[model samples]
Target chain A: MLTDSDSRNISIRAFRIDGRDNVATLLDPAAPGDRLKLLGDTELSAAPASPAGNEPCPEETPAPVLAALEPIPAGHKIALRDIESGEDIIKYGVVIGRAAAPIRRGHLVHIPLIRSLYDERSGHLDPETGKPKDISYE
Target chain B: MNNKTLSWPAYPRKDGRKGIRNILLIVYTVKCAEFVARKIAASFDCPDVQVTGFDGCTDNQYAVNLLISLIRHPNVGAVLTVGLGCEYVQAKWLSDIAAAEDKPSKSICIQDAGGTGASVREGISWCRGTLEFLSSAQTVPMTFSELVVGAECGGSDYTSGLAGNVVAGRFFDRLVDAGGTAIFEEIVEAIGLKSLLVQRAATPAAAAQLADVYDKMLDYCRSVGQYSISPGNFAGGLSTIEEKSMGAVIKSGSRPIQGVIKVSQKPPGKGLWLLDSTPDPHPVQFGITNPNDSEGLTALTSAGAHIVFLVTGRGSVVGSAVAPCIKITGNSSTFGRMSEDIDFNASEVLDGTCSMAQLTDRLVNVVIETASGKLTKAEKLGHFESWVPYKYQDTGSAGTRRCEGTE
Candidate 1:
């Protein structure tokens, strides 16, 4: 439940599709230290980032505050909870991919950091152009 | 919601259907005839004069069926078939069908016409006269109930599922509720939502049809070792095929799906219909299904869609040959950058600037206006592209038959 005050202070937002989702999608680009107000599918709103000086009021903040641990692009995913290496990275309440390395909460979750379990080449693309790097034109 | 009774000006076809555009379609029977056909269409600056055809020299029933469907599509007012003398799919055969349909039609054989220059001149002359006659064709008032709209998504990002497709879904629901036909294709994209898809069926038969198609799609993907997820999708924040599928399927809306339909087949009744364009499994898996977005749009257009909505979160510029393509993007930045190409920005829903209902209303207005002769960005920019590839899928009645050997 987002309080009137919490809604007022929200400069950035992220959407969590389902309650069981371990990741949320950033609605806006964020840098380290930016607070993301978590918006869920229903009326539930998670607490604002703690480091931004919003004290955790239990009733208003059923979920923990998430601060950007790294620079994340808009439309990208962010880790809502600490994920171990090789653990499934869940989104839409389904395993979208696996964490290639242990990801900290609020850190950017994307290719190279996370790899698709179905397609091995998902991690082997050129990050800048999103083109397959290993394939030859021959 | 107040505009539920809104009607648009549309040409009434001889077959009791309505056409939003009075298109002069140039059909090239083979790759050899393409140059002449394109040259003829290029002579005219009118957007209504467009070109589409198969490139193969040999016979393909699927390709022929698709061509026939295009000739008979409600939007096409006139058709001119061009053939290189020896192609198996004769230009005269197609012209005869158009003539039977009462559409101003003609056929030209390049070899018999003397050469490319002579054939182009003959085609240009016929098109000029035909366009003049079609320009004065009377239009009747077409309501939502008589409309058939199709939707497809490409170059998708995270915003597609969250905002773009969601808005499209809402609009589809409204369209279906108003008793219009809505068709959505790209069955390969629905990777992990078999149960969800089956549950949306309007009848038990439709449910079984959805399940069978879903199973075949999965098997086809497994056989090819490629799901529709692309590298650009990953760059745009989609992580897996299942994740992408969930996003892609949302554009179909929550309406009770009428049933599954094959390519070049019209929905028997009004409501939502899923078009399965996946090639049937064979001893050797051959033609790539929907090699590009244009092919998917063409599939929908061949099914009699008057206008097609192309939702692309990352943005796309291509349009279809028969139906006007309305490009939509949920990413405001992409819409901003590609404003000339993209038609609608559903990003307002994501930005909290507008509610879904409000945005859906605005989208409906766009559709109504487009149906009334307001050109979409694709049409205005002359982005009419169609791809008809050679793929083997049974053209039997929808939901009545499965791919050969699949049973």
Candidate 2:
């Protein structure tokens, strides 16, 4: 992380809240045209495995940023890597919730993809409306 | 932030309390007189003068205590009381308390003054003279120990847990190291954080006290049927009550748990203390009210906090009454959208433009500046919200103490 290449002209599209997190928070909208830095050798796009014939293929050349699939707002999570269904959505080194659906890299990981185990209502927020309801004792 | 290096500007009252800001407080004892009091305070259009009142006609224990505690707050240099004349909680009692403390105070009854217009005029006239007189209170140097800083996080998000509170935690660590009192509240957010907090207790007794707070908060939530975790939290990247609890306590850093204090009760000793704002932890209670952000912030002030650090991930433009709220946001987008309302950006820490330590430095500088009387963005924007909770606890069998004593 202290390497020159890590800090050199990297566009911070999102932040991985912790080293253990499978998702990262976008600092800027990751629109279809925007390119984002994928920290810690986490590839924004994992290349097709060099045709099975090329055994011990040349060392993996790392790509720093990848093009976003859609517009993802700042503060919203984008999958750092592919997350399987029921996998814990980790942030801040703790499991905040679990993914209810499969999440691909650059895909938004929010209410639509994740459901909260804490409350009956999904993830405390209405993703589309952005209106917040209180965590009621009711 | 060394107090030795920085001399905080303050009003050295004869009451032995150092006030960061000397303002004339106009309080309305009931809803009927609130308009007059609001008019009087609004007439000043000065940051030094603020308006707050109890909207209840019948005297509730919590309302009376909140009024009394706010009136006696260290930041108030003088006060003027406005009454509808028939309210159960008399404005005269509020005026008398301020007078007893040697604070210049006056009282006006709307019924006797003939009408609302006259009352507002009378209150306004008295406040003008009082604000002018109190404006000259002697200045004094304040030490860190005399400072009470409150930590609160609202409109939370992923960055709130990772950046905002972490920055505040580092600041709180330094504040406690310098022997100042630091309070982080909202036990309603601490449901699943007991294990994380218990280890930080300075003593076994303190650990029990910390555990008791968790139990009580959980109980209160169960009885009321709601936890503190809200939909906004999920929208901002928080999931569960336990997760929110874990994030919230991070603002207190590794400070050892001091005993818990309740709403309107000052911390008995310095260091880190929890201001439990829920109704008495007794089994029989009215259950806790679902408090808004301002209610929670005002509750923190009632615990003697002179400065409030409110961290928002979703963005809030509010500054509660009595104290100047320093708004901080860990979300870069939110900061961009609400930069004028927000004072500091912890989102830079998340974006990696700065490290957590650097963020802490920024926060400390803002705190020092605010303590020295620099108005926060919220204060400048005039977003003052204050209210007393209608929460009631059974005083029949349990002691009247809402926040259990350190003993």
Best by TM-score: 1
lDDT (10s digit) by residue, model 2, range A32-51: 75667754212211212111
Model 2 regions lying over 4 Å from their true place: A1-12, A20-23, A29-74, A78-90, A98-117, A120-138, B2-5, B281-288, B393-407
Quote fnat for model 2. 0.27
What is the C-alpha lDDT profile of model 2 across B1-407, one tens digit per residue? 76544568788766677888887888889999888888888888888888899887877887788888888999988988999999898889899999998899988989999998888888878887887787667898887778899989887876787678878888888888888899988877776555556666777766676777666666666656676765556555544555576678778876787867777888878899887776765444544474578888898898889898898888898898898898888877889999999998887765556777677878888888988889889788777788875666442321233233221
Q: Show where candidate 1 strays beyond 4 Å.
A: A1-10, A17-21, A39-64, A81-104, A110-138, B1-4, B284-287, B397-407
Winner by DockQ? 1
Residue B247 local lDDT, model 2? 72
Instruction: Kindly list the per-residue Cα lDDT of model 1 for residues B332-377, writing each as its tens digit.
Output: 9999999999999988877667777788889998998899999998
Q: After superposition, how far is residue B397 of candidate 1 from its true place, in Å?
A: 4.5
Scored against the native two-chain complex, candidate 1 gets a DockQ of: 0.25
Model 1, position B14, has a per-residue lDDT of: 89
The DockQ score of candidate 2 comes to: 0.16
lDDT of 1 at B238: 71
| Candidate DockQ scores, in order | 0.25, 0.16
Chain B TM-scores, listed for every candidate in order, come to 0.97, 0.93
